[model samples]
Target: MTFGGLPTRWEPTGESRGVALVAPGRAYSPAAPLLEFSRRALLQHGFTVQQLWWDSTTRGEDEEPEQWVRRHVEAAHAEEEADHVLVVGKSLGTRAASYAAERGLDAIWLTPLLVDPVLAEGIAANAGRQLLVGGLVDELWDSAIARELSDNGCDVLEIADADHSMGTDDAVRTAEIHLEVARAVEAFLSQI
Candidate 1:
């Protein structure tokens, strides 16, 4: 499907309780493990998932990275008719945090760039519930900032020894980490 002139993959459930707008990281497509499992979790919870794809090559010369991300996310969100909306983003995709905050939408941010002042402030300003997941080894993640956001009422999951991809050297442990994230997502969905 196409939303806001961008190619998107829409998965509709029989009886959806809400709509999940999934924004992928620059390198991480919707098919990536973290996003793919998260989409599955949303589907299990009765949400119609609309997964967006970004083409950086199409970005305008004068547009900043954050502006480009916000443009696409806003476009997709504008097309949603559901009252309950959830924004699930990762890495570059997490740039949409401000949009979610302004719209008072719930969100799940995976490996968010906690270093970006604008994004950090946006997450802190979110009016609805939020779940923030990040690996301790990720350079973009700041433990202090994550804790601060947690204190502001956002649920946080910090994985030990995991990298930006939420993976460790051991394949078994990486798989377990993935499962753990999925379970966390499920639990969060249950609450809100």
Candidate 2:
């Protein structure tokens, strides 16, 4: 799929009933290793997957990341005829996905960015379920963020001893995070 003069990173998968759309973190490319893990995790649980790379470099200076995400989502859903779209985003990408969900797309946001009001408004607007993967022990996140999300009706899933990335650079923790996401996806898909 394509958006705003930039080429989107989309992969066709064999699974039916669900499709995953992942947005990479800031300064991260579409080819980042995390995408592979996300793809495999979803595929393992029977979901077709697609990735959309949304970074500062890909959007216009005044453009909202959520708007960009929505465009990509519309194109992907139309082209692929996907039954449901699960949005897996990291950092700023999370912000974008949450906002897109608010705009009335059926999605499950993974590790969504909860800091920005613009993004938060969209998330609140969505009225859809969310999955939080942040570490409970990390200093970066406190109870307030979690409370705010829950207050806004997001279903928070805290990962103990994980960081903002939800995994150590080590292989074992990375695998664990991937597994957690897979389980969350399964649960979310089952509900819908």
Candidate 3:
């Protein structure tokens, strides 16, 4: 099934023991820069990446982000039952990940949009089994929500001294942040 938008490229390696679905942020495509970074990072951790683009009706014609994700996830499951699906999302994509969690899918949230109570409930529901990464400085997630997530069982990892992007404008700093994200995901995926 096409799931509306562009289908994500699945790079398979013999070492890959599981499948990961990369959900894009907002109206963005699965191949967007941030998603690509996460995809490569997952590959490093030995997961075959399935980049799923959310066709956002809110952002464009006939592109409802929520519907797109649900469809993609169902399609993914039909194609191959993932040992665990690591749902990585940006701003809007974060919301989509939460929905996936409610359906009992394992996830890895990057800079999740915690303002939404639904998202929190999803994270709380999947706590230690899934890793939740957020910036120390992202206003999108408030302290109370953070506490709730931790209280509910989410493994909250704060990116210290970083903003929403988790890195300064310097190339070296960005790479460092990416590497850090990669390591965290790899460690978490390894444990699962």
Candidate 4:
């Protein structure tokens, strides 16, 4: 299908609980491990998931990232189930945090850019049930903001010795963190 003139892949289930928009970080496609995990988890929870293909080639240097993302999300939401949208954004895609806040949608932010004041504030202001997972060592990951978001009822997972890629020296530990994130997403979806 097409969304906002960009390509899209729709994975809809028969008995969906809601809609889930899997926003991929610029580095990867919706098939990226992080986004794939989120899509699978949402599918397991009976959500109709739409994986958007963000056309980086069309992005203008002077364009506002928030508006760019919001336009696409809004376009997709118009056709599918959207009463309970779960916006899952990672890395650069985290710029869409404010879009979620504006729409009052639940979200799962992986390695979100807490360094961006506007993005961070959007994550904080969004009243939807949110799962914010970031590594303590990642430059973009701010422990203080994570703590604040946690204090404000957002489920925050601060991984020690991990970096922006959710990786550490130990491969086993990294795998465990990955599982933990998926489980947290499942739990959050259940609650939502």
lDDT by residue (114-189, candidate 3, tens digit) is: 8777677767765336667777677776667876676776666777655666666678877787678767776776
Judged by lDDT relative to the true structure, which candidate is superior, 2 or 4?
4
lDDT of 2 by residue, 9-89 (tens): 434455466676667666655455455555666666667667665546767878777676666656656666665667776
Per-residue alpha-carbon lDDT of model 1 for 107-187, expressed as tens digits?
999999999999999999999999999999999999999999999999999998889999999999999999989999999
Candidate 1: count of backbone clashes, pairs at least 3 residues apart or interchain: 0
CA RMSD per model (angstroms):
2.5, 4.4, 3.8, 2.8
Model 2, position 147: C-alpha lDDT score? 76
Clash count, one per candidate: 0, 0, 5, 0
Clashing residue pairs, backbone N/CA/C < 3 A, model 1: none
- With a 3 Å backbone cut-off (N, CA, C), the pairs that clash in candidate 3 are 56-63, 57-63, 57-64, 127-153, 127-154
- Runs in model 1 lying further than 4 Å from the true structure: 2-12
Q: Please give the lDDT score at residue 106 for candidate 4.
A: 89
Using lDDT as the measure, name the better of candidate 1 and candidate 4: 1
In angstroms, give how far residue 191 of model 3 lies from its true place. Answer: 0.9
Predicted candidate 4 versus true structure: per-residue lDDT over 1-192, tens digit per residue: 766765555555676678888777777677776777888888888888888777766878887877787777677677775567788888877777888888878899999989889899999999888999899889999999889899998998888877887877888988887887788788887887
lDDT of each: 0.91, 0.62, 0.67, 0.82
TM-score of 4: 0.89
Among all windows of 10 consecutive residues in model 2, the one with the lowest summed lDDT is 6-15
| Prediction 2 global C-alpha lDDT | 0.62
Q: Each model's TM-score?
A: 0.94, 0.69, 0.75, 0.89
